[model samples]
Target chain A: MHYFIELFFSGLTRGAIYALIALGYTMVYGIIGLINFAHGEIYMIGAFTSYIVASVLSLYGYPLFATVIIAGAAAVVWSGAYGYTVERLAYRPLRRAPRLSPLISAIGMSILLQNYVFLAQTSDFISFPKLIPDLPFMDRYADYLGSSDVVILFTTLIVMGILTFIIRYTRIGKAMRATAQDSTMAMLVGINVNRVISATFVIGSGLAAIGGMLIAAHIGQINYYIGFLAGIKAFTAAVLGGIGSIPGAVLGSLVLGLTESFATGYVSSDYEDVFAFTLLVLILIFRPSGLLGKKESQKV
Target chain B: MLKLQNLRAGYGNIIAVDDVSLEVGQGEIVSLIGANGAGKSTVLMTISGVVSCLAGRVLLDDVEIQGLEPDQIVRRGVCQVPEGRHIFPQLTVRENLDMGAFLRRDKKGIRDDIDYVFTLFPILAERRNQDGGTLSGGQQQMLAMSRALMARPSLLLLDEPSMGLAPLMSKQIFKIIKRINADHGTTIFLVEQNANQALHIAHRGYVLENGRIVLAGSGEALLTDPEVQKAYLGI
Candidate 1:
């Protein structure tokens, strides 16, 4: 029973990270209907940006919390840049082309980005120092979950809240929703559809970057290859929740995260990937629209 | 005022609107009427900057706007109520209207305009919270017109505003368009397949066929002209 509570909290924390990254996938897909395979590399870039920032800040005698915040901010900026450039160079030109070409380009971009990072930085899995200050009640709190897990959960909730606020109230948010609903209507109404799409990518990538930083801080280590698997898992979560829904992404991530933890706990870890894909396949078969996704009707 | 000179537009090598030239003066309701594939809608799109013009010039009040982007054209007070009533399916009526004024910063005026639109189309007020996609076809047409009006545009381009509508509903929409013009004095350039209804309220009219302006005259004159009668009125 105690271990169950522990596993539950641990799963929730991991789910938060997945949810954050999955948002990028859902948001980009919502606007442009592209899978944006290179989005994962944005996650990888974010982790490295945070690692470099925090490490340098720590060496310069900055406090742990301060350094972590700065690193997190840097991660957000870098990931936003990554998303913007990818949209302008990789995806925008192919707007009128066949779908397959853009999908292939996205994959090519992923490979290119991963290799670029690998060449620029060392191939080794570098560690991000423990910059988050652990509370004194850490072990006592861990009767159910770790402090970092609590931090992840709280951060996810806050970010999700802010995101909801933005989507529901602000002008930019309205533009994004309009673009998602119908690009032509948005353009006709003077909503810069391209700008909205770019903003969606930026916001999504920024979220993923923030998540990457948090995960790196919690685990204290990361590598370039980390993004590939994490990206797949996040994509799975996005599709599982419904590719266009914000809440769906978070809920799907939690389910995927819990499933991963349990698979490792009760079964061989080797079967984790198989289990996630199996769940996705089942979802596709049983409820093709997704758990929360409302099925859209074709007008003509 | 909007003017087009020798406008040649196409979708690929197969030309849809060819070498068309026409003008819509300020504060007048001008209607473009033709059959399917007659390029009535294509002329509006080229003027609205949705489709590129292969050759010729588009001038809004003598400011050349031939190659401008769609949003820029819209920003210059040219709002297009697209064919098919392309309202954002997932958005609410309020959000759709807000997007019409997306580039504007006048908060109080925007609020007032929203109120006015509600008065113009009370059903939109009732369905303000409903998603635009779920509205009935007639209601969607109303929403699209309302959204275009939200921009307070100088030149409103309406493409097939009566499309997919019952006869009674189409009459009601046209009545509202007349009311909007009378009350606001907003210039209108309307496209429609239903030539009879389109010419009913138009101050002047142009007839497009095979991507060219086959005829142009005052609305009543064109409605009675022997050429327009044979070609468009099917008399």
Candidate 2:
């Protein structure tokens, strides 16, 4: 029973991290109908940005919490800037081109960003500073739940709640939904569609950045290549729930996380990737549109 | 209030609208009637800046607006209810109306306008919270018109407002169009394939054929004209 409880909490922590990254994929896909392959690199860049800032601040004798906050803010801003630039340089010019064109451009961008990071920073796995401190009250629950796990879960919950509010009631949120539904009509109604697209990229990248920082702190190490595997897993989560639905991404991530945890706990950790991919394949075979995805119902 | 001179525009390589010149006076209902392949919608799209103008000038109150973007044109008081009543399918009817007022910052005025549109189409009021995709065709048309009205446009460009609707619903839409013009003193540029109904409401009308304006006159004159009757009205 203790083992099961431990696995469950671990699953929840993993789910929380995956949810943060999956949101970026789902949102970008929702607005533009393209899989932004470069999104994963944005996550990596976020991790690196936070890593550099946290290290510098810690070296300068800043308080732990302050270092964490400053590093997080820096990560978000830089990731957002990169996201905005990627859209402008890579996707915007090909907006009217064939759908396949932008997709190719996205893949190219992902490779370019990965190489750029590789050249700029060392490929070695640098140890990350533990930004989340061990809370005093968590000593009793330390056997099942760590302080970092609690922080990850709490942050994810708050972020999702805030995101829901923005999408439901805010003006720009309405504009994003409107553009997703019918961009032409959105323009007729005076929405700057380009600006909305840029905003989507920035917001999505920011979420990925937060995920990057949290996971780096939790694992205590990060490298330029960390984003590749994490990105694929989160994308799988997004596709599992429903690529274009917001809540679907979170649900999918939790499911994926729990499945990986239990499979590893019961069987072996060596087959973790096998289990994740097999589950995705099974889901695809059974429900091609995804668990929560609406079947294509285009009006003729 | 709106004028187009020798406007040329089309999808790449194939011209849809060529040398089309027309004028719509302030507070007047001007209808452009044509057959299926004629460039009526293209003309309106050119004015709205959805289709880029390849040549010539689009003047709104004598200011050139040919090269402006679609949203820019809307900001300048030109709003289009495109063909097929392209309502944002996932949005509720009230939300659709809110999108119509996307650029407006006046909260109280937006609220009053919402109330006014609800009154204009009481059916829309009932379906205020329902997703726009779930509405019936005629109801969708009502929502589309109401959505455009939320902008409080000075010159409203309507593309095929009566298309794909039953005769009764078409009559209702036309009546509401006239009421909107009379009530708001808004100039209307209406494009329609249903010539008889459109001409009846229009103060003046133009007949477009194969990207060219072949005829123009008072609506009553065009209605009685033999050429228009044979080609368009089936009279």
**A1-300 in candidate 2: lDDT tens per residue?**
989999999999998899999999999899999999899999999999999999999899999989998999999999999999999999999988989999999999999999899999988999999999999999999989899999999988988898899888998899999998898899999999999999999989999999999999999998989888898899999999989999899999999999999999999999988888898898889986778988977667
Collision pairs in model 2: none
lDDT score at residue B155, model 2, on the 0-100 scale? 95
Q: What is the C-alpha lDDT of each candidate?
A: 0.89, 0.93
Worst 10 residues of 1 chain B by lDDT: B11-20
Evaluate fnat for each of the predicted models and list the values in order: 0.84, 0.87
User: Where is model 1 more than 4 Å wrong at Cα?
Assistant: none
Model 2 chain A is weakest, by summed lDDT over 10 consecutive residues, at: A291-300
Displacement of the residue B186 alpha carbon in candidate 1, Å: 1.3
TM accuracy, model 2: 0.98
Q: How far is candidate 1 from the true structure (C-alpha RMSD, Å)?
A: 1.5
Candidate 1 per-residue lDDT, tens place, B140-198, comes to 99999998898999898999999999999999999999988888899999999888899
Q: What is the TM-score of chain A alone in each candidate?
A: 0.97, 0.98
Q: What is residue B22's positional error in candidate 2, in angstroms?
A: 1.2
